[model samples]
Structure formats: structure tokens, C-alpha cells
Target: MGKLGLVKARHLVSRTGMGAEWATIQRYKNLTMNDAVAHTLSYVDYTLPRPPRTSSWTKTVGNRKSVSRQRNMMRMSKNEGAALQTWWANHMLTTKTPFLERMTLFWSNHFPSTIAGTKQPSALYHQNVMLRKNALGNYGNMLMAVSKDPAMLIYLDGYSNIKDDPNENFAREVLELFTMGGTVYYSENDIKNAARAFTGWSIDDRTGKFINRPEQHDTGVKTFMGKRGNFNGDDILKILLQHPRTAETIAEKMWKEFINTSRPNPGYTRKWAHIFRTSNYDIKTLLTAVLTSDVFWHPANMGGLIKSPVELAIGTMRTLPYRLRKNNLAHNLSLMGQSLFAQPSVKGWDGGESWISTQSLMRRSGLMTNLTRGNLRGKHDPLFMRHMPECSDEELMAWLIPVKPLHPLPTQPGRQRLVRALVLDPAYQVS
Candidate 1:
């Protein structure tokens, strides 16, 4: 009920948004907890810069049909995909509503479609837009839209699905990964039937839009989850939405995303799932419940999550006056293991402890070191230092690091020196 002071404000911003930005934390520190949460959910910026030019689906398809041009097509796709990654990274670095972009990134992993898998950056660009449009709106709606998304259709082999020879890739992942969390709730037969139901959902070759070919559709009765009916792709999605586990799956993911990387408590997840399902899968409603829950604000949970590459790199840049020496942030992120458009697998990046492997830890530490190298020297830029918040040493430590510095602070008294020490400390690795 009281105002969320500096510590609490940082937790909310770092967990929900891209980073615990200084100005944002200062703004939130004065507001009541409820007001702060409301403000975070409400603020969103929809404007996007012009996307990088990529080959149209029609052109790409034409090229793919020719054996000699196939290699050229692959090269083109790789080049365009890298540009797409950079474009998105730039947006995340500068977005006014980092929370909106953060949620968009979350959903992207939940329903992944890779540049390599699709070979269509244009379609992936559209898919990213669709994800952001519904990021905070409705889970059920997003599910329906993404299921037919052209990038997903190609990535999951859904576009190749026809009545005569049904491709089960999309159905299998939808049941196992997207909705149910695993094979525990649905049967193999359910997946086969669900695949049959989704048969005719394909992409328009000329326009690259979702197009249902009724002639290719299987109009037979299918039993999905013990319910028998003549079904289509929409029907299958509607049935999944009605399943309780669909809501629970998202709730559990939110736990890992916002709380900590440990296994989620079912008691908490089930309660959140009920709220999600009852609200007709309203995303904001579920987010409000999760953000306001006791566990989200618990003292023991502070610094519980390991920072993803985006959080470490983009978050640091946003919070401080530092920038990467090289502008190839997208490539840097790939090296650090969170490439924007190219997830390693359908499971996406296994964040958490996985983000800090021996190789990745070195990269992470090296990044922080490089960003703070200039500041570490006594030759601090007076203009930049003056622009920084005027605060005591203790306050500065709290603002920069989520927890007490794992290593001792510097004996030297310069503000820049202290900041460099806090950032380089092991404790700065977590939120």
C-alpha cells in the first residue's frame, strides 16, 4: 500500500522492463505500489522504425525453386536476418516503453519462429509486429493469431500440412510446448487428431498471408482430448484455450520469467492460472495478479533471476552512459547467446543459469569490463558524471547493483570509480 521506495522500484523495473533504468526507478520510487504497477502496465509505445529491406516471399519462393539460385537465396536470407536482428536490438535499446518490448520478447520465445527455419525476414518482421500488438492484450487472441502466423507456418511445417499427408510438427509443439507444457495432459492420439484438424492452414505463395485451402482440408470427425467434432484450426485453438493447463503453462513461464529460475510452486501457478482463464485469457489481468503477489516482492527472492544477455547488455547501456565500443550489438548478443530473431531451438534460449556458462560468463564479464573501462580511469567525463543522479555512495550502490556488492567496494572516493566497482562485482550479474 505504501510507496515503492528505491529497492522495490528497481526490482519491478528490472524484472518487468528491459533494465532497472535510473530515471524510471526514480519516477517509480515516489508512487504507491498499486499505482506503480498500473503505470507500468499502461505505458506502451507502438511506433517502430522502418524495417530493413528483405526479399519478398514471392521472390524468395521463385529463387528456391531453382537449384543454382538456392545457395544464393540462403546467403540472402542470412544477410537479411542479421540486419533484422540489429534493427530489433536497436529498438530495444531505445524504446520508451521497455516493458512492452520485454513482454514482446517473452511471447516471441514462447512461440518461436526462426529466420533459418522460415528464410523469410519480411514475414518474421510482420510476426514481430503481431506479437507486440497483442503482447499485453489477450493470451487467447495471441495464440490464435500466432498459430496462423506465416513465419510459424513455415518454421513448424504447418504450411506443408495437407489432408492427404498431415504434418504433425505444429500440432505436436502446440500441445507439448505452447499450451500443455509437456505430454502429461494430452495424448499422442490427441496430437494426431489435432494435426488433422489443422490440415488446410497454409500460406498464400504470392502474398505470404494465411490462406485456408478447403479442398486440402480434412472434413472428417476428429476426437481431440476426448471431444469429438468436425474441427478446423480455429476450433483446435478454441479447445486449447478452454483447457486449464494452457493457462497454467503460461503462469509457470511467468514464474521463471519474473520471479526466479527454480521450479514454480503449483499452488501459486494454479491460482494464477484460474485468474488467467477466468478473465478469458486477458494478459494484463494475469500480469497484474503476478506482479502484485507476495512472492514477487518477497525479500528472499531479490536478485533471484540471472540476467539474460539483453538484460545485461541493453539494460546496462540504458541505465548508464556507456555504449558498446562496436555498434554490432546484434552480433555481440549472438556471442552472448540471446540473438534477437534467431533462437537456438524451438525451446528458445534456456535463460537462467544457462546464460552464465563458463564461456558465456567470460563474455558477460568482459562486456561489463569494457563498458566501464573508460569510467574506471580517473578521466571521467564531467558532463556525463554531472548528468548522473546526485546521490550518496550508498544510494549509488543501491541504484546500480541489485544486491550488496559481492566484492568489497573501492577505497578510492570518486563516484565513477565506485560505480565501476559495483558493476564489475559478481552480484551485478543478477536482477
Candidate 2:
């Protein structure tokens, strides 16, 4: 393949997946950009398992009587909550539908919570399933679903909200991080009023399901974002979704994530924001446009982002063909400064230059060493095949990096040699 096909392939792969492995990079190598985009869109989350309409906790909560049951459930070796994290990591590594997994991960960051905080495996699993279901669907619907999500209610302390003592935690994050760009768009009064609107929006103690206690709901007129009514949680959600900055804020963040730029261009950001609003906040619509846009294909975009920990770990496994032990995943990722399900705070990972640090870099290198030698406890030892087909230096370099190698390796370089060198190289740190 020519340089253009390879460059375009890397651009698409980097923007859309955990890593730009050969299997993924090869699919787009010969196809036209339009066909390639269609290929990407074809791989939705429809085939992945759909979660039940309500989690078991939603069905069971009642009071302190069930506390012992909850504790015993957590003690079980076959905890579904712990299992959910492994399932996700394995799926992302093996997936051909990389965008579906990528978007799921993105939205998880956008609406972040830890299973540690939720304290219920079913709630965590169900919330992730809901996120996947609406990953590329309607943002408005997703926001509403999240508002009623038991896991979210627990994580943000929404479960404690009541008429007399409304919790502002969830309401504040809804405006500052989730909907509007930042505190600049909303006021202290707005947050307080929004909290009132969400009062009585809480999960049942025994069922672990969301229940709006009307008796606890503040039905008195409350002004929120300049709109006055006896607004409730859903009503305030609608208001935020319709706000002028909602689309713009999400578009800009999405741009930063996929485009690898510090900030979006003025004219293009405005145009994308309009497209976002006009689509009524359809996630797939905005994403598809960005993927197919000239902005995405710019030469400056390729391999520019420092790969996040998940991207590096999963991408390596996918590209290299390895079977990592489930137990080691979280520990390894956490050591590398990206815990699988436990983000340090609601702001998410603060990814960027923060991804690189002396300790983390050393840990990453150690990981590569373990991977290269099959030294890890996983069954997929001898990670690289001992023998491989001979190839020109150019082709091998292209597989490892999007660009032609400035310093070429020997023709027929040993497979392990190439694998080790590539992973340790500075280039491998970028997507």
C-alpha cells in the first residue's frame, strides 16, 4: 500500500480504537474513506449482550434488613461487579467493532463512577450495559437514564437527596461536567435550584432501584437556568440538554479526544456544534461527521496523542495476540496510573501530559518486558510467534508505525526483537 492509504488508515484507527494494530489498520488500507467509514459504523454494539431493563437491586431494595445479603453477595468469589471489568477489557481487546468499545469507554469517562463507590455489582454491570446501549444513541436519553441510574445515584450521593435536605452533588456535576462545559455556564443558585428539582429522586434501600418520593419532592416553584416551574429531575435534564452550550461543550470535548488537538478550530467547532444541536444531540451523527471530516485526516493528527493506560494495555494485547489473566488487569493498569473502573475523582483521569511520569514510564517499560518474554502468569506465554514471514524493511516499519521509518530495521528482523523494540520506543507511547 502507498503512504496515503497507510496514513489515512492510521488516522482512522488512532481516532477510533484502543490502538492501531495491523489487523485494524489493514482493513482500511485499501478501501475508500467513505467505505471505510461505513465499515466503522457497521460495527455497533447491537451484537454485544444487552443488560436487563432493570438490575436485580432495582427489584429488591427495601431497608437495612437486606444489608447482610448485600455483604454476602459482595463476598462471593463470582462477584458479577468484579467480573464486569474483566469482560469489558477482554471485549475491547478482541473487538473488531472498535468504535463501539471506544465510545463506551469515552462515555464512561464523561459520566464516571467506580464500582467501589456503587458497592453493588449488579448496579455497576447494569449501568455499563446502559451506557453501551446508548453509547451511540441519543445523548438526551442517556442523560435521563443516568439520572435514574442506581449506580450514579449511589456514587453521587443522590440516594441521600430528600425534600428538606437536597443533595447538590449530582446536580452540580450534571451542569459543571456532564452537560454544560464548566461552572462558567451555571450559577451557584442554578445548582441549588437544580438540587431542589432532584429532591426525592433516590434509590430504594432494598430494591436498589430509583424511586421518586413525591412526599419528599419539593413541588414549590423553583427557578433553574432562568426557567421557572415546579421542575423535577427530568424537567431540569430537558432544560440542560436544550441549553445553548450543551452541544458546543460536548463537541469541543469530543474534538479533543478524537482529533488530538489542543482545541478545535473556531469555524469548524461552531459548524460541528450546529450539526450536533441540529441532530438533537445524536452522538453517532456528530461522531460520524468528525471521523469523515478533513479535520480528522490532517497530517498533524496521526500518532499525536499520548496513549491512555487502557489504550496502551488493551491495544498491545489485541495487536500482539495475548491472553491476559483477569486478576492481573486491574492491578497492572492501576500501577500504570489508569485503574480500570476506579477513577480517582469525577473529573476522570485528567489524561494528557499527566499520563507520563517517571514511575509510570518505568512501569510501562516493565510491562513491555513481561509481555515480550511471556514472563507474566497468563497462559498466552511466548507472546510473539518464534517464526514469521520475511518482509522488506518498509513493510515491517509501516506495521509498527504509520510513517515510513526514518531508521529502518534489518530485513527479516526477529519477531521478538521487533516486538520488544517497538513497545519500548517512544513512538509506541503515542497512538
- Which predicted model would earn the best lDDT? 1
lDDT of each: 0.91, 0.75
Q: Write the per-residue lDDT of candidate 1 for residues 316-361, one digit (tens) a residue.
A: 8898888975557888899899988889999888888999899999
What TM-score do all the candidates reach, one by one?
Answer: 0.98, 0.87
Shift in Å, residue 143, candidate 1: 0.6
Write one digit per residue (lDDT tens) for candidate 2, span 1-431. Answer: 23337667766876687766666667788888877876787776546544223236633342224775766544441355556666666667766677888888888888888866765667777777789889989898999999899889988989888888888999999999888978888899999999999998877765667888899999989999989999999999999988878888788887778777476675766778788889998987887778778877877777667788888888777666554565677567778997756778988877766888999989887877777664332224343442222455456556666543334443453555665566667777776
The TM-score measured for candidate 2 stands at 0.87
Q: What is the lDDT of candidate 2?
A: 0.75
Alpha-carbon RMSD to native, per candidate: 1.0, 4.2
Clashes of each: 0, 7
